[model samples]
Target: MSAPRPPAPPAKASGLRRHRALLARLAGGPAPEAVILGDSLAAGWPGPDLEAATGCPTLNLGLPGDRVQTTRWRLAALAAFAIRPRLAVTMVGTNSFADGDGETRVIAGLAALLAALRAAWAPPVIVLATVPWRESPPGRSEADRLALNAALADLADREALLLLDCDAALGPDHAAGLEADRLHLNACGYAALSGALAALVRGA
Candidate 1:
């Protein structure tokens, strides 16, 4: 047998407290208006800027290097807080996209992740398309990423979840949206993303 899986990290106490305070102020107005949930990409999003852009209280529940499986596992922590968001935006699986992880597995994990989120959180989940990455080893290529997005589109349809493309904000090509490293977003990139996502959140 392989090594036992380590325990998942605890939710940030400050974040939970912030959520609770925000929830209390709202008096059951969906606690958090919007929650951005996913890996580093989601983490990089400017939460304050997004709130300003969308005119909603936004919570960032993103953890770096989170795979679909990790996201699924963390649902317990999210649910433990007993906070509900009107909209939850997620963009994950870019790190898990690799030759070793077959396309089928990636799709299944995504599907399961969405299902878990639907069950755990409230309605109006905005599933973000995985963004482009630099030509890094063990990561999926542009073509593969496109394929994954295609599959995700189908998954969104099947589950009746709202699907949005991150590329619109990031840029048409990888070079345009990505920073020098070609993965993370720069200030400009974040602005673009904030605009795109905010529009979606506002139903604009």
Candidate 2:
């Protein structure tokens, strides 16, 4: 009989990675006490300005094309990391325009994402932050944007999860600060978001 091949190396556990993915420097100074889980807004595309402003030394897991479903799938990978961040902040629903349904369905998907976040990160507290509203200018409807905000607001009552209003951080008054596409945050807008989060977490 052919010699039995050496037993294959045991498979790695779920959420474990044998290789490294790129990590954008999302915050400043030391390693983060917090982590940011969102789409492009949380990712510093323009630059590392937000990371410097927050002074939290964050790991930006923001995927530019991420949506509710993709976030859920990708978030699982964080489970293997040694760090259990002091805070986990997530912003989803901004890219749900193609959801092909009403707000109810979107809200349900968000809820599931939140649940998975809570279960996976096991952060002492999770901030279920709303996505900063996008500016439609002449092409998009304000009403649709409002609906996205509403879907996020619907999760205010979730236990151990705090609902943060992106409005308070970036509202109509802040509209002038947005980027050209009206979707991503510009320097001023991200500064506001990073500053707002710092204040909240500091007080806590």
Q: How does each model score on TM-score?
A: 0.77, 0.73
Each prediction's Cα lDDT score? 0.65, 0.60
Candidate whose lDDT is highest: 1
* Candidate 2 per-residue C-alpha lDDT over 1-204 given as tens digits, one digit per residue, 9 for 90 to 100: 222112121133421231124322322224556677766666553336545533555566766655666566666555445466777778766665543434665667666666766676667866677756665544447687677677566565645566667788776686655787767777788777766766666655
> How many pairs collide in each candidate, listed in order?
0, 2
Question: In lDDT terms, how accurate is model 2?
Answer: 0.60
Please report how far candidate 2 places residue 34 from its true position, in Å.
1.7
Q: Per-residue alpha-carbon lDDT of model 1 for 15-83, expressed as tens digits?
A: 445435533444544567777767777777776777875577877767677666666666655665566
Estimate candidate 1's alpha-carbon lDDT, on a 0 to 1 scale.
0.65
